[model samples]
Target: MTVKENFELAKKAYEKWDIDIDHVFAQLKQVPISIHCWQGDDIGGFEVNQSELSGGIEVTGDYPGKATTPEELRQDIEKALSLIPGKHRINLHAIYAETDGIAVERDELEPKHFEKWVQWAKKNGLGLDFNPTLFSHEKASSGLTLSHPDKEIRQFWIDHCIASRKIGEYFGKELGTPCLTNIWIPDGYKDTPSDRLTPRRRLKESLDEIYTVKLDEKFNIDAVESKVFGIGSESYVVGSHEFYYGYALKNDKLCLLDTGHYHPTEMVSNKISSMLLYSEKLALHVSRPVRWDSDHVVTLDDELKELALEIVRNDALNRVIIGLDFFDASINRVAAWTIGTRNMIKALMLGMLMPNEHLKQLQEDGNFTERLALLEEFKTYPFGAIWDYYCETMGVPERENWLNDVKQYEKEVLSHRE
Candidate 1:
């Protein structure tokens, strides 16, 4: 049968469960996932005097056609977004600012540095998000930033973060959407440290100072991220989940939950409901972690489906902010973005097609057998047909057709990057 015929059948089948396939498609299209800009350059931003990636971050492989300048990166981003379905946002790091060949110290950065990005985003009809680059800097080489023992070094990072908030506000104001400014510091010790309390106290004080001047929430929202541990911070990471969770609650800020920032056995899907109870809003950095905090490209894995289900089931789609956070330099950079983003959209569509209310009713009525059976039955549903229809309606390639476009772009554009 043709694609439309299959979709019609699937739509009728879903109607038996009182599910509106059209409504699901409309809702899914409106949910925007912020694609990270670092994937194009493997986290190497165009900053003067920028050193090699440090502070427990590492990007493996030597992929050719990696973006080297702001223009190249933006071009690559445009190509990737073309292949992915639906409207999306771009997530930028502080280091990605266009400074016009001049050196701008991190703490001295201003919104003018990113005026070009604002203009580009405006032209492309994309929203923008911001992150303070807290690693790979001279002051961060010691594996400490906001929690650094040296007062001068700590203050430098604090000022940088404050500046980042203002830049985020600028983007939001220009784009007419709130920009989520997330702060993630790679501050911890490689070995056991007897003075953990001191660093934690310093970090708390530093955060307080950085957030002293609150920007308008309509334009900017603050989010603090926590990591279980990183490469050099295996012993103790100062921004543990507990620390940021408490800080976010007390300070009225959003807490960002990075999937790869927790233990392997811990699924971020389980933490969603609990966090929503206390947080007015929650931010997500969705990535796949093989075993450790390795930022592997995302796929339509079980965890991803579960995460999407949690959001849809709890009716918290508006309360959660979604963003991609993976960097794989092994393959085509543009394809990596396309694959991860398309998979994310696919997962959300699957979640939306689920009969969540019916499942809840079964569980509440102690009908465990029917609930388990229906869950298994859903595995064989015609979700692919619905996904293809959505893609076709959104004016993107239905399936592997996008791969051909990425390959052609690599030959035409990315191949000449050197």
Candidate 2:
């Protein structure tokens, strides 16, 4: 059957619940997921002097055709964007800066280093986000940056973050959308720390200094991300959730909650409502975590659905800046991006299609039996039909047709890469 034919049948089922199918499509189109560029290159950014991946994060597998240059990375991003439905933004790190073979220190980075990126973004009509690459650098060798006891070391990272914010501001001004500049550092102790307070205190002081050179909020939005634990810092992390939560609340910064940054039992979906209550805006780094904080490709799992439901039911679509953060070098890089991003959009669509108000009323009225029944029944609904229609309308290949494009591109473009 035609994609539109299947969609019509699915539409009738959803209309019974008083859901606006057209409105859902429109809303889904408007929601932009910030796709991380590092996924294309396994977090190996283009720098004259590059360092090995460290700071508790590791990208396993040697996927051939990984982007080795700025132009190639952008090209790979364009390829992935072509397969995914809807317009999205690109997230970049400080290490992606192009200095024309000149070794530019992180603190000395300027907007000129990212001019090509801004131009590329402008050409594609895409928004851009920025991050200060605090890991994989000589200064971060001690697993301490911005929280180091040495004032000079902390100052270096402070300057880098300040510089990154300015670059984000530049992106916002160029793209006409406020750029989210997030700061995530890998500063923690491998074993139990006798002086946790001291490192946290230093981190606080360093952040204070970074924000001192204030730029226009209309251009750059600031965010701070925290991790429960990491490869090296299993015992204690300086930027704990409690630390960044309080810091973000008191300082008026957006707290970015990474899905993989929590313990095995703790879910980020449960934290969304509470976070939105206090902050005007929050951000997310949507990923899948295995036994630990392993950055696995996101799937349309139960937690993903719940996370989307939380954002949709709470009516915080605009309030929450959704972004993708995962790297899997095992599969085709472009396919990895396509799979993870499409699942994210699919999760959002599922949330919109749900009878959230009805379910809420049912719960409020103590109709738990009916609520559970409906929830379970809706899982078998024609969700795939609706998703295929979305892809058709968006002019992207429907269903696994996208995989064919990836395979063709692999043979034609990616395989040629040395």
Candidate 3:
């Protein structure tokens, strides 16, 4: 299969999906979903991270345990790849900071370590891409100390972050250019209220420095992972308006949005609409809800689930990279991970099936509210029914000669890209 052939094969599957949505919905009821990452590391040949996935298991996002070694992870990926049929892939939730002496598997931010866990992509036939994580790649600092508000301490924090930036650079240079190097900082403080607008100001200062002196293309996937909180007195970006920080920074960098970080009072769709208002600043990091915590998966909630799909309906979905941000140590890793991936795909497929009239309404509308209201009307429709129908009816199973087919497809796609 050529790249075109592979894509065509996928399109055929999707078209069948479009035609048999009702059938798909019925099948969903009949079939038990077989997802990746279940309880026990080796139960289903999953790479489990027990410490990382500690939480209530059945639903919330959590890791199970160390399922496999790099080799094992690769084998499982191949096995799973053999199962998946041209599905769009996102990432697993938060990858932790490394250990003390591991050989910084990826040498970008060396004196660091690399987990074989992330290596699954290489062996399993997947390509790496970007997801929102990093905000400012500054050097180390205590970050806005007033008593010691001297430039020295603040510089420390900036340098600390910049070290991470070095790691990012290393990734691009050494790791075949990571999909994107993401960062989220714990710099926001709240005790004395140093200032409301400092985080962005400091971030901008750091990024400008990296661009001029450190790396060239501004981190390629430069992004800000924001949250509304404080440690000593520094208030973070409190609302969508503060997104100006991202806009100010965004010639090439992205202002990524985290669904889990949104205030509980806010509607998920409203936040989606709000981000579109600042579309230049808004990149995406996706997950579902476990009450208050970010579950890092597609779930039963109609709002987030529907909102996740809505981005595709408006054609803005691709403006960002997607990743599930869940982490629990007790859950079955494969099952949970698969749920997130499967449902994320499902939600995305939903928004794509919106009517032409609806798309036109959104595209042509002068008023944001009206366009949103129009899109809001079909919340109940099985937007993904068509896609589900296609996959379920056709089956997610690999064809008998799938290895050869995938080899041919990979060869063609790689050839075209290079």
Task: Assess the local accuracy of residue 93 in candidate 1 as a C-alpha lDDT between 0 and 100.
Answer: 96
What would the TM-scores of all predictions be? Answer: 0.99, 0.99, 0.59
lDDT of candidate model 3 versus the reference:
0.43
Q: After superposition, how far is residue 28 of candidate 1 from its true place, in Å?
A: 0.6
Alpha-carbon runs more than 4 Å astray in model 2:
none
RMSD of each: 0.8, 0.6, 10.7
lDDT of 1 by residue, 1-418 (tens): 8778989998887889989998998899899999999999999999978889998988998878999999899999999988888899999999998888899999999999999999999999999999999998988989999998899999999999999999999999999999999999999988898988889999999999999987999999999999999999999999999999999999999999999999999999999999898787899999999999899999999999999999998999899999999999999999999999999999898899889999999999999999999999999998888888888888888878899999999899888888
RMSD of 1: 0.8
TM-score of 2: 0.99
Q: What is the C-alpha lDDT of each candidate?
A: 0.93, 0.95, 0.43
- Find the candidate with the highest lDDT and give its number: 2
What candidate 1 gets wrong by more than 4 Å, as runs, is none
Kindly give the number of clashing pairs for every candidate.
0, 0, 62
In terms of lDDT, model 1 sits at 0.93
In the range 235-326, model 2's lDDT, one tens digit per residue, is 99999999999999999999999999999889999999998989999999999999888889999999999999999999999999999999
Higher-lDDT candidate among 1 and 2? 2
